[model samples]
Target: DQQVKQNSPSLSVQEGRISILNCDYTNSMFDYFLWYKKYPAEGPTFLISISSIKDKNEDGRFTVFLNKSAKHLSLHIVPSQPGDSAVYFCAASVHAGGTSYGKLTFGQGTILTVHP
Candidate 1:
């Protein structure tokens, strides 16, 4: 069962504040973690990622931390802006055997609203 879980359905925060999103996974074999940001109708765009071997990864205003022992991960956005209001999805994937390559398992998604 490849189930990635984002328990929170939505979050609201003020501009210039820190916004945090949480995610969990039940599949222990997932070795790669990714965070994607999406607008209303467009497909999710890759934001940041971390490997199972690393504890954290940061890219400019965004940071992602992973804890393999707990099967948990979090995304942090610093100085959130109103333009950042969108849905965020946490995805996990593992290298497939054979020629399947990598497949992603996505969570239900978390809608974040950054107010001005």
Candidate 2:
């Protein structure tokens, strides 16, 4: 069964507007959340991430929030721009011995379109 899911297939936002992308996970074992953004031909690049211990993490214009009780997480982009348009994938993993490698599970990506 797919543990991580992005219910919305796509989201459209206007430039300078706030864009929120959401995700949900069914696995309670997951303790780390990661968000990746992929361009047309390139690979998905890591955007922002949050540990289950934290409710929110921010990096410049990108922010990621995790709600452990709800098993939900979201990525927010302020002032969405054309360059911010991409496929966003949410991935989760269980932290083991301070390492989370080889246990990552990804959700189906959501397409984000920012119109100028």
Candidate 3:
């Protein structure tokens, strides 16, 4: 079974608008949640992350919210611009013994299209 899932395959938003991406997970052991943005033929770039201890985390125009009880998380981008158009992915990892080795379980990904 897939531990992580992105229910929406794609989303479209006008420029200077808000974009929300949702993700869900089944593993309760996951403590670290992260969001990543990827472009065509490029590696995913880390966006924001929230630990299980935090309900929300924000970085510039991006914000990530996590609900541990519900095993769900969402990423929100305010004033979405054309440059924000890309595939957004949610990842979860368990830092076992502080030697995670950078292993992460990623969602299928949601494509966000920003219209000018």
Each prediction's Cα lDDT score?
Answer: 0.94, 0.94, 0.94
Lowest summed lDDT across 10 adjacent residues in model 1 is found at 94-103
lDDT of 1 by residue, 41-80 (tens): 7999999999999999999999999999999999999989
Q: What is the lDDT of residue 36 in candidate 2?
A: 96
Q: Where does the lowest 10-residue lDDT sum fall in candidate 2?
A: 95-104
RMSD of each: 1.3, 1.9, 1.5
Model 1 quality (TM-score): 0.94
Each prediction's TM-score versus the true structure: 0.94, 0.94, 0.95
Compute the lDDT of residue 16 as modeled in candidate 3: 94
Query: Candidate 2: where is the Cα deviation over 4 Å?
Result: 97-101
Encode model 3's per-residue lDDT on 75-96: one tens digit a residue: 9999899999999999999867
lDDT of 1 at 96: 65
Give the Cα error of residue 44 in candidate 1, in Å: 0.9
Tens-place lDDT digits, model 2, residues 1-116 = 99999999999999999999999999998988999999999999999889999999999999998988999999999979999999999999988755655588999999999999
